[model samples]
Target chain A: MPSRDEIFEKVKTTLVDALGLDEDEVNGSSRLKADLGAESIDFLDIVFRLEKNFGIKIPRNELFPESLFTADSGFAENGRVTDKGIAELRTRLPHADKDTIEALAKDPRIENVEDLFTVNMVVNFLTAKLNG
Target chain B: MRWFWIDRFTEFKSGSHATAIKNVTLAEEHLHDHLPGFPVMPASLMLEGMAQTGGILLGESNQFAHIVILAKVPKMTFHSWACPGDSLLYSAKLIQQSDEGGMVEVKAHVGERLVAEGEIVFAHVDDAANGGAKIDQKNFVFQILRNVMDVGKAGNGTGA
Candidate 1:
């Protein structure tokens, strides 16, 4: 199995190419949308590139869940994510910073779910899949 | 009637999923207008093709009782370029459906390589309920759809 550093390198390269960003823009702490300006369309491009580069098949709702953060998901209340929601997110997003998440917790916009995706989150997800 | 982005449906299942095909050709007028030298199919058009495939599936889900229209594309992304002579296979799976609209997951591929994938949302509008001018050519739309989709295998002889 590749070391975590090697996995991060591959994930970083894929992000740079998929989003057309400079190499320096991608790092462990960089948020995919907030820092990298990745749009809705770019998410598919990123997933596709990752699948091809890693030789894995990512289902439609695994990496970026389709219905997990919706209004009826029980994670959000009045457009804000509840404590229960954050707990659920923590499991799915192991690589995101707790401080960053807490900062955004005051008024989490359900539509801004992409904001929670950091470079490390993807690396972690891929690592888990590879190991499994 | 405007030309459809998808050529025909190779596989279709009502309210579940559908698969269609589109042949990219150099003779297309849109290709000439997209780029002077590069004769590749526009990514936007590929997205439209996905929407068309899903829209048809959604419309048929209710037997065309309402006019289904592409309302929004929450997510759409392209992984590779599709050139002329490439056979584009489009697959759409219905996620949820209601009286108002429906959601679908759509993807496009060339052989084994996935070229594009996204989610398309379509609104089912009851023109009569809204007091809007109804489409007199509903039959025309149905006819064209029938010509493309293999309604016999879909188990809905009426293309529903």
Candidate 2:
């Protein structure tokens, strides 16, 4: 199994490839919508890329907001943002929460973003199934 | 272009049935991206076409009382790859129906050659609620399909 940092790096890379963003723009702190300018269709394409890259099905409802978030909520009305939004972002990370996701994002042991998202998603899914 | 369909229904008691055709053309964009020179229709889209045909069949069977949406494609198999300039035919028959969901068996063929076959499961849904609903047979579904297939006529049969 890959480390969380590696998964994060992979996820970052996938976001870059799927969304067609520059490499420098992707990081643990990078906001998906605002900084990336990803739209609804782009978000779905990102999910498809993640699923194909990791060989796991990420449910659509889990990745996108139930409804579009407004600018008043701190997410740019157009859907961009900062590291603070990372907390809410965890809820959409396939099956992750704030603390575990934050640890993975911050973990120096991780090397790539792909492994981070994959590991986090798999572990979180497994843990949820085991506990639930 | 080629078309593939499962079965041909000449006549039915209550439910509705229909046929589908797909024209495989060199002009299709996916042909280039799927492979360098070898082009095959994406299986997912083929399944979608089958589901669309099936949905129409079920809707017509129940007289359009409910709209049909594909809830799942649990199992699918591709016996042969359809290439450009081939015509594919798909025929579907309603296996079962109820207030919840229904199943249909669809087959695809290129001329007399069997290309692919699979079973599609769908739910009868209300256009308003966008979910499952009970079907009413006396409405529009059966009437539409009967007219399209031209069943009950002596000489009109599925023409391969």
Candidate 3:
């Protein structure tokens, strides 16, 4: 298994190459959408690159699972994430930053879900997948 | 008539994807017949162009080891009409593949404007084992395809 630092390096490279972002914008705290300005299509490019580089198969619903925040999903209430949603997100996205998630939970707007996906979150996810 | 649709491949990356070009001209029979004087390219032909782009990517992914055909077009949408003097650019990406068949996504562009986009599925046929004269025609089709895609007779290399 690769070290955590090694995995982060690959993750950073993948994000930079896939999104065509400056190297400085790929830091750990940078959010995929707000900080890096990643659109929905960019997610597919990122996933494709990660799969090719790491030789892993990611389900279409895993990385940026919009289904989890759908109108009928039990995770959200009134277009906002409920306490149940927050807990589920914690379990599902082990790689995401806890601090950012907590800050967003105050309002828990549906769009805030994107804020959970930080650069470090991707690094952590890859590290866990590689090790597991 | 040949099953081929794309005129030439400008870029081919073996397994990943390909970019092909088809020049629309007033000399083509379909353009004149479809409309009285407007002479716009038919949407079906544009879909065929997209399918051809995806089909080539699917076939080359496995080194032409299987006879690939456009099995189904689950979704296709056209945004604009392509007319004479318009050069269509087809960009194809492989979504997934198996021994039996594969799926691909394609987008057609006239210059910077997107003309069409869709996902296409292809199936690998074995006419040789099924025993038909079509088996011989497969060679003809592949020959024409190889010429346009700049593929080798050996079915290896990126055709760069």
- In TM-score terms, which candidate is top? 3
Clashing pairs for model 3 are: none
Error in Å for residue A3 of model 2: 55
What is the Å distance of residue B75 in model 2 from its true position? 2.2
* Candidate 2 global CA lDDT score: 0.57
> How many clashes in each candidate?
0, 50, 0
Candidate 1: Cα lDDT at B104: 83
Off by over 4 Å in 3: B1-52, B55-160
Candidate 1 residue B7 Cα shift, in angstroms, is: 0.8
Q: Which 10 consecutive residues of model 1 chain A have the lowest summed lDDT? A: A64-73
Highest-lDDT candidate: 3
Candidate lDDT scores, in order, read 0.77, 0.57, 0.78
Cα displacement (Å) at residue B126, model 3: 29
Question: lDDT-based ranking, best first?
Answer: 3, 1, 2
Across B1-160, the per-residue lDDT of candidate 1 in tens digits comes to 4657888788889999999999999888988877778888999889888888888888888887767767667668899888889999999999766565677889999999999998776665565535566666545443365456653456556767
DockQ of model 3, rounded to 2 decimals:
0.02
**Candidate 2, residue A39: lDDT:** 48
Candidate 1 lDDT over A1-132, as tens digits, reads 877888899998888776767898898988787899886556665776677688887776678764566655799898777888878877766656677677667667765566668888788888888886
- Candidate 3 C-alpha lDDT tens digits along A1-132: 899888888888888866667777788888899999887656656766677678897776576665587655789988789998999888887777888788877879888898888888888888878898
Writing each residue's lDDT as its tens digit, candidate 2 over A27-115 gives 65444555566544454445545565666654535544533234455533233333444445555554644554566456422222223
